[model samples]
Target: MGVSPQQHERESFRADLDGNVRAHALRCAPIAEALSGATRASRIYGIRRFFGYFREAAGAGWVLLGDAGHFKDPAGGRGIGDAFHQAERLADAVGDAIGSDVRLDHAVAEFGRWRYRTYAEYYGLAADLGVAGPIAGIVPRVVRGLHARGRIDGVLNLLSHRASVLDVLTPARVLGATGGHLLRAPGRRHATLGELGRLATTEIRRRNAMRKPVFQSGPAPRPVQQETPEPELSR
Candidate 1:
């Protein structure tokens, strides 16, 4: 039996051939050796591109939680832990509303709002970082500075959700990196300044393009209907 071109492209794994493994020999001896001796064939099993979204959080008596409520690129390893945190907050909100004077719907509605506020910035950052390709723009310079200061652990923690993006990419670090690049040799300085201006404009346009419910994960939410009063029977 033969596989279709599309199927082969999507599923077949050709081992025992030159790929990028040779490129790693100097830095990663184990990977180079594995590539040298590997004889097994298996499918590639990692995400090939980015896919993520946000969805309506609550309606009537229904509540969406975890991936059903929202999902972002898993690159940062935040999904499972985030779900657990959400569950805890949700349990508290629902329990209090049930036992107290607050309406259950109101409690859940507020939870939804809180959820967005808490995660939106991180959502944008994750999407930006998870994009496939070399990391670009000012980030590399900023990372270099962090490395020089022995603070790269903060970046690792940011990815693992133990720290915030702002905590690591502070104004001082960003400015310092930009200033350093701007002070490079004249030819390099000109190129660096142009790139910075271009990236800044792109960033501004991106922010302006963003709208509420930034990404819709599923079907559009159904509109709420108001209850109507029944007319009294004629006397």
Candidate 2:
């Protein structure tokens, strides 16, 4: 996958079930020698972002779950885990509604709130990674520096969705790293700061936009009534 300022491109190949790996080998010749006589097969897919928000998740007796409720870029490979987490929360909400006298609709609303709270930081991180720009260049360097300092575990934990973005990439840590880089490459400091500012501004806009309501709920319309037959006239 390659992210550029204009777009993101993901390319991969798949093999047939009959163990015909020749096509993949031909397409990916760099690894052809290693793939010689390989019997396993695999598939590939592209992940894209369709960022959105829904004001309400419950209406009448129905509720949305998983991707139907929210989705983010798959670049982080957190889709499955996110879906599972949503399902667990939804189940808990449903169970409480069923076991107690609470209204299911209210429980579902609470579920949506919980989902937003849990997914907000990860969503921002995924959005940042999905787009190309200065961040693309700076983030890798930052990670490398963290690794050199033996603090890469924090980054790894963030990638694994085990820690919040702020916890891993705190403002102070980011500033310190940026300062060090600036000192080492004083000539590029201006460009780096410009890009970092743009990235931060973009993220702020995205986060605010996400909070805006994208759905509305109202009472269902009444069913239409049928006209009475003229049976009396026939009689």
Clashes of each: 0, 0
Give each model's whole-structure lDDT.
Answer: 0.64, 0.62
Model 1, span 157-176: residue lDDT tens: 77776677678877677767
Candidate 2 lDDT by residue in tens digits, 1-235: 2122233212222113122224434455656766566544333222233443433555556676665665665567787887787788789778857744457877887877777666776777886776564445567777887899998998988988778877876677767777887898999988879867876786677668667745523422222223222222211
Residue-level lDDT for 127 in candidate 2: 68
Candidate 2, residue 159: lDDT:
86
| Position 21, candidate 1: lDDT | 23
State TM-scores per candidate: 0.65, 0.66
**What TM-score does prediction 1 earn?**
0.65
Ten consecutive residues with minimal summed lDDT in candidate 2? 9-18
